[model samples]
Target: MKKPKQKKTKEIRTSLLRRLAFLDRATLDIDARTVELAFSSEQPVSRWWGEEI
Candidate 1:
């Protein structure tokens, strides 16, 4: 008996270093906690909630 061939799918992966390289090093001044809060606080969706205000 012969076995059937299976198709392979391409996998996608992300690299943080590659992405960070595009941004300024100075922008990394924010602490990990601050970034976590900023992202989880809905600040990104509400302009008034962000520090820009």
Candidate 2:
């Protein structure tokens, strides 16, 4: 016999929503558009010349 699958509980969903809300509030204080990209090393170039590349 196969067992039944369980759904996400209310507590777990509430906690996840709360964390997302906190992250949203935190990011609101920062200027994302003015942020600069700082790469220490050079980016790699893919050798494959496929359509997905």
Candidate 3:
């Protein structure tokens, strides 16, 4: 019998886990813009949000 080929799965790599819910501006004592910047620049989570993860 022939062996089945393995499927390729995308993996995310991050030094930290940044939860968006916890990144809220009001909770973090920062403005919305600052929170946005934090979320946007975050490496791993950014990819997941952008669907590139």
Candidate 4:
């Protein structure tokens, strides 16, 4: 069976925008030039990576 999709509200979007909306022009420029290199998560080890937890 298929489930119905959830609806979005303006308030939720406004909240996210509020977090990204900074007043400092220099900070905004810094963020614009930044690039993500790598990331990691502390999940349980699995045999797929030759690790056991």
Model 2 per-residue lDDT tens digits across residues 1-53: 99899886665333433212123343343556443333342445555583331
- For residue 26, give model 4's deviation from the true position in Å: 10
Question: What TM-score, over all chains together, does every model reach?
Answer: 0.20, 0.17, 0.21, 0.21
Number of clashes in model 4? Answer: 0
Over 1-53, each residue of candidate 1 has an lDDT whose tens digit, in order, gives: 89889999999785664212244455564656332112223233435566642
Rank the models by TM-score, top first.
Answer: 3, 4, 1, 2
Q: Candidate 1, overall lDDT?
A: 0.46
Better of 2 and 3 by TM-score: 3
Q: What tens digits encode model 3's per-residue C-alpha lDDT throughout 7-45?
A: 999997759754554444554434443444344433443
Ranking of candidates on lDDT, top first: 3, 4, 1, 2
Compare the candidates by lDDT and give the number of the best one. Answer: 3
The C-alpha stretches of model 1 lying farther than 4 A from their native spots are 1-3, 17-53
Residue-pair clashes per prediction, in order, are 0, 0, 0, 0
Instruction: Supply the global lDDT for candidate 2.
Output: 0.42
* Clash count, candidate 1: 0
Please give, for residues 1-53, the per-residue lDDT of candidate 4 as tens digits. 89999998675333433223225444445647754343344555657568754
| lDDT by candidate, in order shown | 0.46, 0.42, 0.52, 0.51
Regions more than 4 Å wrong, model 2: 11-53
Q: 29 in model 3: Cα distance from truth in Å?
A: 26
What TM-score would candidate 1 get against the native? 0.20
